[model samples]
Target: MIEASLPALNRRRFLWGAGAGAVTAAALLPGAARADGHAETVGAVMDGMVRDHNFQGVVALGRGGRIRTARAVGMAQIAQGIPMRTDTPLGIASISKRLTAVAVMRLVEQGALSLDARITTWLPDYRADVGARLTLRRLLSNSSGAPNPFRAAVAAEPALLQPPWIDTGEAVRRFATGDLVFEPGARFDYVLSNWILVLAIIETVTGQPYREAMRALVLDPLRMRHTTPVAPSEAMSYRTVSPPVEWINPRPPFLAAAGGYYSTAADLLRFAHGVYDTDFLSPTSRTALTTVEVASDSYALGGRMRTVAIGGAEVRAAWETGNTNGYRSVLGHRLDGRGAVVILNNNAISQRTMDAFAEALLRADAGVA
Candidate 1:
């Protein structure tokens, strides 16, 4: 979910200072919190963010294969003042990119696509020089150096900042005229156009709209019923800045596979269950999906990955964030299957706050001090 700001806040990261560091290990670890009362500590932290920061929405913490804390702290909902729930659907900004990325890699694992193949193999009419140098791997890793049309447009025509989500194919074709910033794979360039081309590839290979293909490949298989292109009943959108009120009902279909999807915390967890399960992806596929690329965003095939020092151990984790319009969201999981946290906030919460939430949960699993 690309936020209203096109260029700024380009990648996903948890703000480390602030309240994030205040989370006591006792409040998060299994003994004090998880055993005696799981929701109390984490839920209190959520409340603090709502009280202090602009955190409005719900969070669901899962461990031992079940949801431990499904809590909502604040709300400025426009939906008849309905409260936030675990099922409340909200925009997950660029987090949607991972969904598209996983879908493409799934096809690759199925032998229906090739990661090393030039993007033009599927998009023959694409500008030859540009396409020749662009591979699915580079595109997925955001190192393809594709020109960033969204950023350029945001700079030239501020009015286009909230431009409608047009057809993915059209966006891919139009952006094809753009020049590459560097030779493919030469640097870590996180460009949104890379996924535009990936969307086009999904259509070319699957002969289906990227939307439908995503449903079949990722959502349906995982039974992510709440994850949809259409917004849910209480599904709210917003922007807390100038000339802006509290709520919005944005329909950004043109964002397509890039950042156009509604998802609930539970549904996102179900997605995690699927993506992390070997049955959902082969061993080799999971490695490719989670292996960090050399430079860009610590991005793997679709989302980003990093190792966090928790307690006394290094834990591998996969995480993604969405910040389009007023909604801010985050989802993360440990590779060792310790824990996962999903937050879908309709009100714009700071990335640091969400980071704090996830950090507390992950640290709890490892008995952090």
Candidate 2:
């Protein structure tokens, strides 16, 4: 449930370099008194969520590089009675897209890829007509007209949801290749095929498997030691909190670049710091990452960038959310250096409530009324 006191954010503007883009690491860190207050605010809201929604996972609020509040509520594996911990890794779902986008940008910075070039430059095997029209920027921004065939197919044949592992090339050919649902870059559609094709491009460009390329480009550099493309033995998702019926959501190798990965709250926070607080990305790439390309979706490259008004103060941030099976996650990183909010859950709850919770934490951390 959402906090009644916290006002819903009004996303009125898309401001780049207004928050995280201009701030230094030293300025983003909070003082001791502020950190204490932030912890109190987070704890109170988290306690309420656990009591009301049966939230089962970890929630962490951090500023600069230090964690102000990190709590684990409910159980990771209900059948085994394994309690959740702040370090417990949980499936991050589409948050993996943000990581994949970053990896692709790194390649662009290295002169290995171009954002405006037609996808066919790298994916010659793709359908010529469609590939010639789609570009890396359009795909990253979810403006690629790629149709979501997997969704319909999975609904008709549940078995198709998680088949045996397939290589990136095969996955792209079977699932990603499709007719354009709309003119490329004419509108927005959050299709999984875009990232699937992106995975194939990454593999072809780097001459490495998706996981290996991700490790070399992103995970290893960020020191996200606990994050992995392969699903780890961590939390077990539940459809219901009282009886805790298991929800099976498998992550095959081909889906790694889309919505397939497990991560801890701490590791996710580390990623926020690496991306926003440090010089991990080049200036051009960093700017490109947060520049709003799709205004209707509030999307930049792989994530949403918008201005949130909290307590009469407008805060610019990168808001990334994921929900699949019974797992849900949110990563809110304030570009203004106030901090970040990371929530990972095993039991499916209202996404609106989760988003509100994260925003409330941000408001409290910023001490905005």
Candidate 3:
């Protein structure tokens, strides 16, 4: 859902100062600036985003289980005048998939499930004949033929584009009747429907909602106090709470496994630390999280496995991105967690800015020109 009324953004200004180069890493302290004077380059770019664009959020960098820099910029709500802080909660869209994946994997680690098992083994009534033929890995890897549930939800509930909210059950019920776009595992097509089905399976197996399972398996143990599956009662940003004209508020079931998780910069850093430390999954499981099982170049079980180079530095980057209506986010870490960046914006801001910031961090980590 998108508000058609908001003024068109200044594309040039939105991306000003963000370019591909060997800029300083935000993970470094201010004093850590290189003698060549590129160390504080990240801070300058972040400062520019706030001072120039209407960017509002926090940016945190963590390495080796230590938070090197965690700073907030702009206001949480432009009208209410609330300042963004480390603990300021933000809707981290599809990034939520990683959390959901981790929860499901925990069940797998417990011998409660297998990634390759057919969905029919768990939910016999799951619609799509192709789904019965699909395995959990295919779903996680975006190879499942499921179409995005959101598209179907919007088409069915035409009023969903506006504010207020809708019931979660309606979304689920509507989805239960849909069919897959193709036979499972035959090809990779990124679809939110894959995760919604995953959530259904989790509920069928655990006898609890997907949110409850995640809180139990991932959030609690990691002490991610600021992270949860709870939907907000009000808009957290100055931006319109929901899409305009349609005026539909965010509702549960609609959020399911595809989206609907929330967290703060502080909490996300903690999650990064936990993953690097293997606090939630075993060493083998941790390896699986980063290991590339598929060749899509954008997704994995619970995170995205990709690579990017900044200057002369080339590193394997595991990441996930999410957006819903007014939210946009990027969360990913380097292989060693030596460099990780979490950027969340309320509106459809430029992801290129986030990517440029990440490139800068990789440059600093590699200590290259």
Which candidate should be chosen as best, given TM-score against the real structure? 2
Tens-digit lDDT track for model 3 on 261-328?
Answer: 77876677677778755566888677767765566655567567767775655777777777676677
Clashing pairs in 3: 94-322, 161-246, 161-247, 162-246, 162-247, 162-248, 163-247, 163-248, 164-249
Colliding pairs, model 2? 19-335, 19-336, 20-335, 20-336
Across 209-277, the per-residue lDDT of candidate 1 in tens digits comes to 877899899999888887887766665665652233566545445456778788877678777767885
What lDDT does the true structure give each of the candidates? 0.69, 0.79, 0.64
Clash number by candidate, in order: 7, 4, 9
Among all candidates shown, the one with the greatest lDDT: 2
Cα lDDT tens digits for candidate 2, 1-369: 223322221211111112211322233335765555554665566666766666667777787755656666667787776767767789888899999999999999999999999999998878999999999999999999887787776688666556666667777877788888999889889888899988889999999988999999999998889998665565788798576699988877777777898898777888888887789998788889889999998999988886778779788998888888888999999887778989998889878988888887777666653
* Deviation of model 3 at 73, angstroms: 1.5
**Minimal lDDT window, size 10, model 2:** 9-18
Query: Could you tell me the lDDT of residue 268 within candidate 1?
Result: 82
Error of 3 at 99 (Å): 0.4
Cα displacement (angstroms), candidate 1, residue 59, comes to: 0.9
